[model samples]
Target: MIRFDTVSESTLMVHLADEIDVSMTPLIARLVGQIQADFPEQLIDLLPSYTSILIHFHPDKITERVLRERVQHCYQQWQNKPCSTQGKLIELPVFYHPDVGPDLTALAASQAMSVDEVIALHSGATYTVCAIGFAPGFAFLASVDEAIATPRHAEPRLRVAAGSVGIANQQTAVYPAQSPGGWQIIGNCPKPLFNPHQEPMTPFQVGDQVRFQPIDRQTFHSLGGEIWPHWK
Candidate 1:
């Protein structure tokens, strides 16, 4: 719990009571907004480890002494309010075959598992998008099953085709574009995850639920569904 009190003309204090994760982010957002709305002059400094909140403000607008009083007011508001955690779920189809997952054998060997075992484990779980980074549509799906935990190739591939699904550090990610990466390749999804020409170029966002459905080679080529035929 964050406590509020008068301190100085340019500083306010915010505090936290627990670990910061995807679930608690909403609460933090609410707090951040509250401080910004009430004390527009203050800068919010959040410490996730100790769950401490510090408010640094301009001495000219609200004095350091009144800052404490303002913080107290905001803290009470936060306590009485609720944080939201609503999100959407998405399922993408992935094609995992020898051609696409050339390194599957290598990866399977590294983990001492058969190729089929690797695919089953990879596609069996509901993954949460921990974060969207490293590339335009690249997402860090939360930890994969412990059974298939493996490392990326020692030598990062020069160019990995777009839609390539790779695993690293217990998480699986789809390469939205043709980019060089070291994550162990296991599959590919034909769906266009990113298209700058279309509206909302990005498909997935942070915290979205994503599940990969596996398909074979023949289906992969057949389902390469034609892009909107503007001329034909």
Candidate 2:
């Protein structure tokens, strides 16, 4: 539980001091729904981190006293009530080939592991979609295997391919589209990570769990992989 206090008449923030796991996401979502329904004038801001939910609100919507009372009520409701939200589970297939994982060789050499070993370490682990930022459907992932926690590139790449799977710090994620990034690329997933044309656009939402299953280039092509042979 967070102890929230109004710092100013126009601003309110939540200090979430725990992992932003599935358990807390729906609770916060419910609270936000309640607030939006009750007070449409206020704006809610969420910061990305394992811990902390920050909220900013308008002074005219409600007074500090009223806001405090309301926040407490919402917080209590989250604590006592049971959550009834179910998020979608998605599986993306990756083809770990020389052409796909451009940095595979260098990454494997740095870690003193073979390219196959690196791929196995990455896809074998179940990763949490921490947040969708840095880019659209470009997930901020968590819970990467301890063995493959490689550092970001010293010099960021000018053009990282779309669908490239990469890692940084203790997290690993797939780059939704071709763009410059520093995360170490180890493989590529043919599926569109972020497709605005699709129903929800992004395959994984915040707090959704993502698991990767390995596939060969042929399988990836057969599974409806979209590869822009020439990136421009």
Candidate 3:
């Protein structure tokens, strides 16, 4: 069931589901696309998250009631439309060594597993892009294997390096830029996930698929990946 609520005079939040998962993302994406296509003149922008789509509209262009009607119409149309499960599968190269991932050793110790076993579990599953938030290109990938599932750090680091991969509870993600975060650091991706000058800016979008591949230190450097010494 879809519920509509007003966030502000100019914003409407469309609640698509009560929980977050890969299955709900495609519907959210499609509904967003449909709304944008159908109401280009009235829509200011659309912000998508794990379970909801925040629709910002020009109140002067369209009244609140009219906007809701249009959104409801779009939702009805989406129900009859075929949704695509095929999203771009992005394979990211990650170096799980302690030198790059400071918390790798500690995480292994906490799980009662060796470093190699932890890395294998973390890289074994294919994750779906549930949302893109927390920062630019910072994708929330989900359903980390239970064997390696861990909690966030009690105290977040002041600056998590760009491309750092971390896991918190059932979710995992890469830090696309230097920022404060608490997720347990396990590895770092060599590729830049976000670029302001690029066309898409971020390589990922809602509903994309992601898989992490373990790599060596030499390969990490060869790929132009950098790790801040402060992180070690």
User: TM-score of each candidate?
Assistant: 0.65, 0.74, 0.91
- For residues 1-232, write the lDDT of model 3, one tens digit per residue: 7899989999999887788766777877777777788789988988888889998999999888887787687778775677775569999999998777899999899889999999999898999888888898899998799888898988889888888999999999999988999999888998999999989999887778899999988999999987679872
Tens-place lDDT digits, model 1, residues 105-161? 877888898998889988888876655668877877766888787777778877888
Clashing residue pairs, candidate 3?
none
Q: What is the model-wide C-alpha lDDT for candidate 3?
A: 0.87
Ranking of candidates on TM-score, top first: 3, 2, 1
Off by over 4 Å in 1: 1-85, 225-232
* C-alpha-based local distance difference test score of model 1: 0.68
Clashes of 3: 0
C-alpha lDDT of residue 231 in model 2 = 27
TM-score of 2: 0.74
Q: List the residue pairs that clash in candidate 2.
A: 16-52, 16-53
lDDT of 2: 0.72
